[model samples]
Target: MSDNYTKIVQQNLHKLYTKLPPDLERNLPGHRNGQEFMFNAFGEKCTITPRAITLGDANYPAIHGILISLYALNATPEICLLSPFKSFREFPDSMPYVGAFTTHTEQLLEPHVPDIRKSAALITRYFNGEDVPVQGGGDFAFTLFPLPKIALCYIFYEADEDFPASVKCLFSNNANRFLPIDGLADVGEYTSKKIVDLICDVNSPS
Candidate 1:
């Protein structure tokens, strides 16, 4: 499966390079020097060229590589509009993936709310994000960019006398302009996974 995924990523990179856009920098909202582009992806530095997509200093899993490439391929010149964020289910034709998106992206973080609240500052700094005012009076909330052109806002509600802990993930209003719908779902899942990993690392014995 890993081998197959690698091949798929390579093919996607080929496609991205073949029809490379002249305004890629503007569209991706990333920096370009010669042929290489640099940007933040899921809280890590990402470098992309015609040959490969690398995160930080290593080659990441194929899923990440594929999503990064797709983000570039679908890059648009329009700036990201984050106001009035929308939920995954709110998007057109997003019903099929909504359940998985909820489970993997939102619910995945529910159990770690207390840890997240404690480390929210660290998480925001790592992801180059900032705290945002909660819209509906939740326990806490913050917004982070999982990709250069896409921002995700995570809202949390602590368990209380009558209800259990819950989380909600919302996308920047125009997130779809930078990736296809399914790709957007994957972005949320991967970003959520990154958050969990960061929390685990912080809690691990040193």
Candidate 2:
């Protein structure tokens, strides 16, 4: 079971929620979770609203508003269920960049879909100290960039001989490649570099 990780994350976020205005609190009890958390707020019980932060792109910037929404869900559970929420002024600094995505990313969506399950298995084996290389993992790294956007990122490592089986990974807007389970720090760096190269290549006339 996922244990409603979003809800659990919301619970954790409440402990640190701050800077909420009285009127906004009254308007929309205030949420501190992700997009879903804030969407849960709306209606007669609340009436406060603040402008959303700029997330480079409009429409689907879950990372932009997730922090504030998570807090609202945790701190003001009662009035949060008002109408569709429209405030994200109190977003936090440490909220993860991955947990609050608002939509399917075209950044790395299509190309990476098929790799998810296979890579997951490799991650499991490597983290386990099994020395298993993720399929498609070349001598360098597997820089699998999907279509749309790269909304989610993670790695699975199975327990190894010397170390307990523990999948250690983190989501990063920066990781362009995957680190081989054998030894490496990251995997997404290669993918990102390639993306940059492609951009530069197109721009370079010569």
lDDT of 1 by residue, 2-109 (tens): 878778778888987887889998788789998899989888899898877789865565689889888888888788999899999888889999999999999999
Residue 28 deviation, candidate 1, in Å? 0.9
Report the lDDT tens digits of candidate 2 across residue range 104-163.
122332334333333433432322212223332222122122211121133333334864
Worst 10 residues of 1 by lDDT: 53-62
lDDT of 2: 0.28
- Cα-based lDDT for every prediction: 0.89, 0.28
RMSD of each: 1.3, 18.0
Residue 37 of model 1, lDDT score: 90
